[model samples]
Target: MIKAIQNIFSIPELRRRVLFTLCMLAVYRVGCHVPTPGVDAQVLAKFFEGTEGTLLGLVSAFTGGALERMTVFALGIMPYISASIILQLLAVVFEPVERLKNEGEQGRKVLTRWTRYGTIFLSIIQGTGIAIGLQTMRGPAGEFVVPDQGMGFILLTVITLTAGTAFIMWLGEQITERGIGNGISLIIFAGIVANMPAAIVNSVRLLRTGALTPLVGIAVLVLMIAVIMAIVFMERGQRRLPIHYAKRVVGMRNYGGQTSHLPLKVNMSGVIPPIFASSIIMFPATVANLVDVTWVQTLASMMTPDHWLYNVFFVALIIFFCYFYTAVTFNPVDVAENVKKQGGYIPGIRPGKPTADYIDIVLGRLTFAGAIYISAVCVLPTILIGEFGLPFYFGGTSLLIVVGVGMDTASQIEAHLISRSYEGFMKGVTLKGRHG
Candidate 1:
């Protein structure tokens, strides 16, 4: 393992990319500490403390507690993510977007431009709403979150937060182009990890107190690590379908005879389904806070975390999005047609509609398994925590994101190392060890 670590540093390009990614993440963490203007930091912190079960808490979790801090980056990359999701959904309904998607690389560049614009627009709208919400908020100590609430403060917040989000989006693009792994995912990964030390401290405090037993705390820690490892294994798992391409004569030379496999990931949706489901379920609760209606509040209560309705709806949304996102991203019919054009056929499956049908069937089953896997990983732990009164910091959605992203980043690093003739730790530990 140590030799592999040294081997990674021996490859200059991989080392540089890793360093650059780390530096960018450090910058994000720093920004999370820089407070925004026109808000009392203490009051904002207190208000967040009181909002433990609300949508605000969910937002805070995504931001790694930055929202609670009322930092310049309090809004975090969530607005950008939301904007991208909206644009992706719109591409289906909008003719221009659909055409652009089919146009290839050039079209994708154009779509990217639109996503960026949409991100900025969403940041502005969400920032303004948050500023307005702050005006009406009070801390447990009866302190106003926004002491001076007016057009000036609102406009200032709108400009500052929107600019912050735009800058973050730019940073993510830079990382993707010049660094390693995915920039946006890495940003969120950093945020989630930033909370780990605090979570550990809180858990330790709980253990020290009579509130949590040592044995229970230790058991939770071990179980959490085990769950994380299981997630890593499943996320990296794939089903590869073998394909054979027929030999073709091109002039005097024969070409195209080869064997390759199409790899279909078990968890093709990755962490997207849970992220989408959580956001969808939380949106209603967020809106409910803004209204003064009894029925809405009642409805929100029914869907609060740990509630039966919430779990049912959450599971349903995860399953729905697992299929929805898979459909959006992967079209087996298109894959089959392309494979057929290239003179390739899956073993034992006839090349045209049959191949497409076969691929779709496998994908459907995988998607179902994926949906159940995600729900169990995300919801089951939360249910246990609720039912058994386990420590909140060690299980559920936050842990899943942290584990999944960590695994993804590690895999990317391993790829980089292996591609450059450097040894990967996995090589020494398992059959997949790096070759140098």
Candidate 2:
């Protein structure tokens, strides 16, 4: 590992890219600390103390506690992510969007522009909603979260948060274009990771104060390590389908006689299922806070993170999105067609429709198993929090994102090193990405 680190810096371009990515992340962390104007920081913090089961708490996790602090970056890059997901869904159902997807690089550029526009629009709406929500929020001491709630404060907050998100979007683009790894995912990874130290400190403090029993603390530590190991193993696991390419004569030379395997990851959907599940399960609570209906509030209260109903819905949604997102992203028919075009066929499977069918069946089974794994991982943390009262900052979704993103970034870094005639982090072993 030390030699690999040295190798990375030995390559000037790689070093520059790594440094650039670090600088951009530093900027994001800095923005997380810059408070939004007109909000009472103490009151906002106190309000967040009781929002662990609410949408605000979930959003705060992604924003690295910026939302809890009412910072300029309280919105984080969620609106951008929502926009991207919206575009992806549209591409599946909308003809124009599908055509645009099929148009190659130019089409991709157009779609990206559309996503940016959608981000801005969503940011405005979300920012305005947050502003309105703040006006009615009170701390545990009955202090208003917003010191001066007015149209002026609302407009200023909307503008500030919108601009912050726009800036983050730009930073992500820059990192992707000029730095290393995925900018957006890395930004989120950084945010989740930034809170780890605080969580650890709090846990230690609790342990010392006898608030957290040593047995429970040790169990939490063991669970965390075990969970991380499980995640790493599953994320790298793949089902390799054998493929045989028939020998063909091109002019006087034989070509196309080759054997390869198509690798389908155990978790093709990655963290999307958990994220979508969280959002969908938390939607009622978010809406309840906005709407003043009695039944709605009751429904929201019943759907807290610690509630069994919430867990059921959360698991169901995770399973649903695992299949849905996998279907949207991976088309067995397309893969079959591409393989056929290259004169390759899966062993024991006929080319064309049969191949597609076979692949789809395998994928469906894998997706089901993946869904189960994701649900277990995500729900286990909630169980711990509810039953043991542990501070689970490193929740299941956060773990998945951190591990998945770390693997991808390391894979990219390894590729760069190998391309430059340097050894990767591990000798004689290649790191496979999530898609593989």
Candidate 3:
């Protein structure tokens, strides 16, 4: 591992990319501390203290606590994520969008441009809503979060937040083009990871104060390690379907007589399911926070993260999205057609509709198992917080994002090292691509 670290810097290109990514991340972290104008930072922080089970807390986690401090980056990259997801769903529903999706590189560029436009629109809407909501919000001592409540404040906030989000989007794109790993996912991973030191410090403080017993603290540590191991194991899990290529004669040689396996990942949908689930389940709570109504507040309170209703709904939504996203992203019919075009076929299944049907069946079963795994992981943190009273700040959704993004970044690093004839991080180990 030490050698791999050295090797990364040995390659100048890789070193430059790594440094550029770090600098971009530093910029994001710095933005997280820049306060938005016309807001009482202390009061906003105090307001967020009691929102651990609310939608605000969830958003705060993704923002690296920027929302808690009402920073200029309080909106975070969520607007971009929302826009991308919306475009993906449109691709599945709208014929024109679907055609654009199938048009290859040019199509992707157009879609990406549209996604940026959508991100700006969503940022404007969400920024306005947050500005209005902040004006009505109060801390425990009844102090308003936003000191100035007027159309001017709202307009200023909207413009500031929208501009902040746009800048962040540009930063992410620059990192992707000139740096290492996925820019957007790395930004989110950085946000979640930024809170780790605070969580550790809080845990230690609790342990010192005897609020957290040594035994429970040890258990929490063990559980976290176990959960991380399980995540790595499950994320790398795949079902490989054997494919045989028919022999073909070229002008002077024989070709296409080979066997290869198609690897279908267990968690094909990745972190989208849990994210979508969280957003949908937390929508009512967000609305309740924005609109002050006795019945609505009561309903949202009942849907807290620790509540049984919330868990049930959360699990159901995760399962639904796992299958829905998997279907949208992976079309078995397209795969079958491609395989047929390449003169390849699954050993037992005939090439065409039958193969597509078989692949779909296998995918459905895998999606079910993936959904179950995702639900278990996502709900475990809530269970620990609620039942065991553990001050576990890292939720399951954040864990998934962190681990997934970390693995992807590591893989990219490993690829660079190996391409340059250097040993990878896991030298003499079978787990190369699988572990990354």
Query: lDDT (CA) for every model shown?
Result: 0.83, 0.90, 0.91
- Score candidate 3 by TM-score against the native: 0.95
Summing lDDT over every window of 10 consecutive residues in candidate 3, give the lowest-scoring window: 427-436
Residue-level lDDT tens digits of model 1 in 1-436: 6877787678888788878888988888899889899899887776666466567887888887888898888889998888787777777778888899889999999989888888888888899888889898887776788988899999999998888888788888888888888899888878887877987888888888878898888788788778877787777888999999999998999988899999999988777898888888887677776675999888887878768889999999999999999998788998999999999999899999999999999999999998898898888666876788887565556777777776777788888766776556675542233542
The regions of model 2 sitting more than 4 angstroms off are 213-215, 288-293, 427-436
* lDDT of model 2 at position 154: 93
Kindly indicate the candidate among 1 and 2 with the higher lDDT: 2
Task: State the displacement of the C-alpha of residue 320, model 3, in Å, after optimal TM-score superposition.
Answer: 1.0
Better of 2 and 3 by TM-score: 3
lDDT of 2 at 426: 91
lDDT of 2 by residue, 1-436 (tens): 8888998999999999999999999999999999999989888777677677677778899899999898989999999999998999898889999999999999999999999999999999999989999999887777888878789999999999999999999999999999999999999999999888998999999999999899988888888888889899988888999999999999999998899999999899999998888887887887775577999999998898888999999999999999999999899999999999999999889999999999999999999989999999999988888876787657679889998899999999989987877778997675454444
lDDT of 3: 0.91
